[model samples]
Target: MTLASRPAVVILSQASHALGRKIANAIDGDLHGASARTSEVDFAFDEAKAHLSYLFSTGRPIVAVMASGALIRILAPLLTDKFFEPAVVAVSDDGASVVPLLGGHRGGNDLARKIAAVLDGHAAVTTAGDLRFGVALDQPPRGYVLANPENAKAVMAELVAGASARLIGQASWLSNTRIPFAADGTVTLTVTDRPRTAAPLELVYHPKTLVLGMGCERHASTEEAIELARTALADSGLARESLSCVASIDVKADETAIHAVAGHFGVPARFFSAARLEEEAPRLKNPSDIVFAEVGCHGVAEGAALAGASPSGDLVFPKIKSKGATAAIACGPAPVDPDTVGRARGKLFVVGIGPGADQWRSPEVSTMVAASTDLVGYSLYLDLLGTLADGKIRHDFDLGKEEARVVHAMELAGEGKSVALVCSGDAGIYAMATLVFELFDKGGISDAASRIEVQVSPGISALQAAAARIGAPLGHDFCTISLSDLLTPWEHIQRRVKAAGEGDFVIAFYNPVSMKRRTQLAYARDKLLEYRPATTPVILATNLGRLGEHVRTVPLGELNVDDVDMLTVVVVGSSESRTVVTGDGKSWVYTPRGYSGKSDTGMSKEVSQ
Candidate 1:
């Protein structure tokens, strides 16, 4: 079980938080805490068991700073596939003992060791192979792929039973292990980059010594690039599992075909600048003047392959061209680190955080924010992110500088940084998402900005929060309108308000009233009163999901500008909407979905029957 990018260190009590923080820092993990019991954590969870299960299901390595028995109990039911489950480690509350509960051979044992080292405690690694030989043959270190894990148990058993093995190929780590090596032995361990099958008593390991370099024309089909890459590997007698990464010129970073080829081989897609690739011109076997003229690189495929592999790496297969794509293969002396070579494609995530509450924020939004290298947003919205905003490069903008904030985020992402543009409520509803696309459509941005990837993550909207707080006022049809006439003309706003009134649609008003702009809300109320009844319920939900939350209802005729503010979301019920006052003197608002008509029709049918 390969752990995902970041692990989660969970603490259930404030007493364990200090130890949890130490482990989290050592591993660069996010610290999570039970919301009701702990504070000042990166993420808050309502329940420990549910959160642990969620983290495990998402393939995130977990280091629970709790009792081993309790942690096991929470995750026991989910223990199905050890090969796919993330590492699960348990650390004592006082940080004395670290135990690898599951996925020991995968990552748990390693994580436990690291944490134990940090906490100055003991790592209770109970894996038989690890304890005996200081290595798990089934799970080799990075840059080496176990060809046949199914055959590992038999080989490990033989070695554990005091049988000697012969090393057929180069493996520095294995030499350091406790395995007894002999010139003539029954069991065998072979390590090579070439494609080979293991015998029944032999273990085969593939060193990731190959780099697949690719280049494609703009808008090239993913199938063509993938096929070209596969053919290059097959024709060169190379194993696909031996590839470290798929690489190309930086200009093609966002090109779908380049990413598709990388995805096909289950490797990262790295990129090199044209100048960087051009530096390898002396090493290219197929240097093309045409390519140099096109992208300032004599050989994108060969250059990228050599550059990505290593300075002394050689191209095993020269550039092979398809209709609109080219591929090559290079062999390095050792495994290549994709991150050491070049930058990744830039990405801008336009995310909405909902109404200032951790529980209201979507898991997708949290994930994106955690992955981002930079946070760009209004200052208050960034504050709402709480500890999730820790360690990020924050570019805080004042309110009303929405365009500036969006542009900054785009420019940062254009420079190969993962940037999150934070907004309140839903990003698509009167937020930065519209402006992001608008700038793209207008086409005034830099080349890098235009090519950067953009993703929009939805959040709980103010309208939804307002409706939820005040029963189901939005149970029927509803439309949201912004009352701020700063960007939009008042006539257009008046027209939308009048139209919503005429349509008898339940209306939710955002930006209902600002300091200088108070009359718009009154106009909307008067306009809505013309269509709906004076006694119709009007819900004013302020600070929907945050502290000092206030939700109240009043008659449409009595809706005044003094009662509304910029922080408030005004929801006006339609003619069919009703307000129910309970015995507790609390008012709840909801619009019937014409259930009365259905009931009456059913009654008539029953009477006829």
Candidate 2:
């Protein structure tokens, strides 16, 4: 398994915040600080141990700027399997000493060394194998998998005790290690692409040198495709861990069966254009004119395998077929790099950033934005991403051109790029998600755009934020109405306002007023007063979750248009809503759930008894 890329640098005291920032910047990680002591950080937490435990549970590598003993005590209970754990390193508050306390082979030693380089300190790595041989046998380098890990401990112990080992296959990484190698030795280290069994004093490593090319008919069964590929690998006597990637023609980039086969092998699915595959016609063992007439390529499975395995590679297995799928395999001269060979399937993420705070942003939204190659949204929405948008290619649009931004995002994703369409509040509620589906339903978009994957991630809305800032004015039923009337007709908006007022539903007005539009909020207040009392509470929350947040309440009779703007969300309480003043001279508002009626009935029954 690969190590987690982005680490989190955590600090307990304000004094360690500076050192944490330095380490975080060096590693391109997020900085988290104690909420009671530190102010300026990417994230703040109330308890250090709880936060650290949460980060660890989420598989986030941690670099804590604190005492080693304290971190050990806090995380001692969570020590399970060492191989699956994330790297944890503890650094002194003065940035002098660095120690890898957990996941030494998984990445803790390397992370501690990197942090020590930034601080000009030393990494205290106590692992015997790492300290003596400068490598971990169990944790092989990328593009190589250790077949038998249970025997690694015994082999390493023998090697550390002055036993000579013999190298069997082509392995440049083992040449640099501090291993005593001889022409004849008792201990053996074997590396190959073929399947092999290990002896008692042996460790077998498999290099990812094979590529599997696949093709399937439309709506083919995923099980059939996977079984065909697995049968081909087994018949050829090849290890599944030695497979580099699953490749096919670009037209099948969105094919479910092809992607499923890749997923089954835990490898990436890459695609090449038909023309690129046609160039390998001379090397294909099975080329057909009928296939060329159908797909513009002579052989999809064989051609893709040869092309993906590099020019000098050899096709080992040629054109094995099932009822609806074809599979082939090829061996390369060296380990293949899947990313440099073919294009990946495109993905579009419609993400809502909530209001503006990092704390309010959902974890899935953050992960989508970080994985995105391009970010498309309004200027203010892109600006809200702050440091997270640093390295991304940004496509900014003005406020009035909402359709233009969504189209640009879709077009970018069509070109095989991961695009994030940023939105404020919830993406599905008055956001770009509806427009995306509308484009798909209307049949006006390009074919590539239609084939690209789409995902919607939800976020906290402005109404929810406003309701939380004040007391729960939305305790009962509620509805939201946009008052701009730019795209919506004024008469339709007025009718909805009248209906909500008659139904006595709590109303939250979004897009209350722009600079050019006014008088809508005042008209809504007048209409609501006809059903509810004049003393009903009206909440005006401006800049929710942003820098200058403000929430206040007023009587419905006193509500006016001048008090609201585009940045505000206005909530009008129903007739049953009540406001109370606390001892601190602050007002809170909430709607009752009718528990008083139940109390009265219970008291009557007691009196009868």
Candidate 3:
């Protein structure tokens, strides 16, 4: 299945002997002639798994020749992946062009025409979409990710009717867009990526469109302005290149940021009228004394685009400054056109940075945080992000109550903004993420919230971080019991701890010893002593991965009651978890390697605590 351009023609020759020479010649521009493989007949295909399927997968359209019904049957299944399936056309060995089967997009349809031209005959072309519209934008060869696959056929059909069409989304990243639909004050959009610059009348898929207008002092430092702008975008988790253009007054053509920003995104810098700017001054981020005296524009692109939107989304300053400092303007969740309703869905991400530090933060969770527009959490959690939290909308509430924060973040996302509800440690380990779904499951989310996208990006849990800090106590089967009893009964906690002890499983205790709940860890330790030796290693990693953190691993008999706290993770090692000293005398912890399938490394060869 060597894919080439769309086929010019499909030759249904009775045998390869008649037309093989000419067919190979046209395919490669160089003549392979009739000497190609010809003994490929009358054998089971199971014995003939020898055609070059690799060549067809190169994304080149191919012209496939099916000489017989057996060939068609074999080729039919092969063509399903759009790789090996090239344009297939059939011709009689008498050199008469006949049936042209599948693939107008593949090289088959084009090949049929080429072969017909060479043979002085007519090629069979049955595709109306190709003949009518020529090429379409939604038909980008390799990189087109259409938001609505179901509506594509209808959209294409509408385009073929020669209706005036335009594309308004990040879809403009495409090279071959040929839609015939127009925006009649209806803008369908996806706020996930930068949108292509478009007129008022195009159908677009750019989900991350925003109009930014700046009025800075003459020769404002590009670094200051850029940093400010970048902070605004980064805080929103939106890409900068998605800015269609930097729209400004004609006076500031020499302003470096206008060109810098446009050049950064590889787009044009559009100029708006000063009079229009005055009309829009009301919508700018700050009611400035300077901009009025100089640029005289309130919101250049932001206000105009908002005014242009179908529902005319409200103008707001999502960013704020201490005084008359750097400035910005934000617009939209501007109602998408009826056609663009589902173009791109908003995303809500819950991130868990394990127990107070960067080392325990999972890379995936960090990425989601960096891509979020707003950060909602207890103040300390948001503060942990530091510089990363500079530009985002921060909703810092009190500790022990994150349910309201989660609801707020989801609401923001429903309005077309990407939000991150921050959690401590793993989002699913007694974190807000599970509560979010549980809330959604109970119909707590609205219609808009339901339409918004939500996904949980997990991070390392506190207990995992604690265990890793001490030893591989959780190497085998283990149970995590919370001793707080705030969410569950103390009797149930005792029952679980007793079961774990009876089962001889290692136990990782969370919320082990708080100021009020002091006896559970002692009770659990007492219960564990009944099942095994009292000298088992007890790893206490307190305030792990944070400032003033300390790790202590001691035998169970030497466990200190004073060191354990609610912040501490208590790992009571199993029979196999051991302490070992490396050749360099560095004390470390690892589970016995017995189950690692390397039988050579015995348990006794290493030092154990």
Candidate 4:
């Protein structure tokens, strides 16, 4: 059970719309309606329980604006362990009462209080331990991980029954928590990051305060790095689970072993420049001239540890070495946030925005765009991003300056800024992704570009969007061929088109025709007509997934070169493809998947040329 980072409000009655809107506005949450009175609502749904179930399945905390009994009956079947379930609250339609029905300690109680304050109503929090004391032992504030949660019920009962408890370590969170601590009590509550087994009457809290600094030889095995890092932590009696991050020099930023160790420890891998590491050379226990000559830094492990340490922090454990790796530990005055201390190894994300539509965009693409500190692309593509490009340094180039745009984005990433190279459709399909790798292969890839991490996020390609809108014309085997002769020779394009037609595969033609190039669409249609019938369904999808989107099914013989342009995607159906007009009088084109031979399903209809 994962909690949604964003909250969602579900309304069941028209009377609750105003209250739902108020809660949504106050909580900065999305609204699912019971009516059409408010245009600002994110969505409107007719079935209240199913909509709530859908939002619940999305891992979002739900605030249902309905009777508490009704919400309880609907959510009863989906209930699981309280430890993992997301917060679910019930708010009255008139905003008079706020009740935390489930996950009261996890997040429901907090959400109920917030909603209650907004509605000027009282929160009915029913958690037993919270009423007796001010805090929930199982949910011990952020930055504190509760270990031995199974023992929470027994200890809380003991405390409520007037039994005393002992508090160990610096638990500042307990200052205002009113946990009924007794200095010499039998129930021990330890708040240190150490590998310790909790007794039946005890609880353990691990605080994220350790920063592990590591350096490894090129292509070192992940097992070697993990063993060496674990040994260092074991010798120093530090819990590996408390590690905040793994810090290293930027040159080792791409080191697989370092990332593997960080992953094993469930922490982020952070990197710093040679100059930043050199600033900590004076604090290094083992400074090396060879290291300085190779990486422009005197030390790696110790230097990186100190660099990530607090202003007054020191290396608790000096550099410890393995056959191919070195590890060190740093103690900070506060929790270590590696992001603030070191310059991250630069990152470049080649993202596809997917035909300028928000819904068509993938979550990974949205994440990459949001993580980017700078955006680089063609001016029109960048403009298509709309508000998603806000607060970023925009570097827009012309349509033809593909190389310049890619190089500039890579350089910015090399300079330690996260850069997004935006593309219109799928980045890997005739887009900037290939150009990036080509630059790397041609030795035009700069050293900084070489060190920078590159990731390609896929988008909804034009062919895919077109196929979906036109009802699975590409249901069978398919191939995509671009007819652009500016790069590839026209002879090669003709050969691919002919081969696809002969192979009985659905073909999606990109760059079918342009203002200057007119003969390619007609020529390709003539070649496909030889293998497929004249009445073969041809789908012309223009501006797919965007405003003014148009889709029409025509026959191969009737395809007009005058009607096709660069913005259009032409999908030519295979020999087995068929078209049908549904009961609503809407045309649907689909290719037989061959299950029709054994099954008695009526799936085929006649096609008109």
Task: Pick out the ten consecutive residues of candidate 3 with the lowest summed lDDT.
Answer: 40-49
RMSD of each: 3.2, 3.4, 21.2, 5.4
When sorted by TM-score, best at the front, the candidate numbers are 2, 1, 4, 3
Tens digit per residue, CA lDDT, model 2, 173-220: 897888888978778999988899899999999999999999899889
Q: Which stretches of candidate 2 lie over 4 Å from their true place?
A: 1-5, 599-609
lDDT of 2: 0.89
Better of 3 and 4 by TM-score: 4
- lDDT digits (tens) for residues 200-274 of candidate 1: 989988899899989989999999999999999999998888999999998897899999888888998888889
- Against the true structure, candidate 1 reaches a TM-score of 0.93
Q: RMSD (Cα, Å) of candidate 2? A: 3.4
Clash number for candidate 3: 45
Estimate candidate 3's alpha-carbon lDDT, on a 0 to 1 scale: 0.57
Instruction: Give me the runs in candidate 1 sitting further than 4 Å from their true place.
Output: 1-5, 13-15, 32-51, 600-609
For 1-609, candidate 4 gives per-residue lDDT tens digits of: 112455778876566667887887777665666544433344556577787887776667889887889888988998778788878988887788999888787878988999999889999997877887778888877557787888888988888888877888877776456666778886878888788889999989887778889998999989999999989999989877667788998878778998899888877788888998898888889999998998999988888888887657778889999999999998776667656767667889999988977667775686577667899999988888765575679998998899998999988988778899999989999899998888878867677777788999999999899888878887779999998899999999989988998899999999999889999889999999999899999999999877789999999999999988779999999999999999999998999888656444334332211
Predicted candidate 1, C-alpha RMSD: 3.2
lDDT, candidate 3, 1-609, per-residue tens: 111341222222336534544654554321111112332111111122133233234333333344535445655555654323545556556546644565555445666677777666677676666566555334333322333434545555555555555344434433253334455523232324442443332333443345454444557666666666666667655555444444455555445665565566554444445666566555544455655666565544453333322234544434333222243444445322312321123468888877756545664675566567788898988877654464578988896676777778877876656788888887888779887887788877765565566778877776688677765667777777778798889899889988888887777788888777778888888888888677787878877777878887877766766779767888887666677877987666555645555443554344232
lDDT, each prediction: 0.89, 0.89, 0.57, 0.83
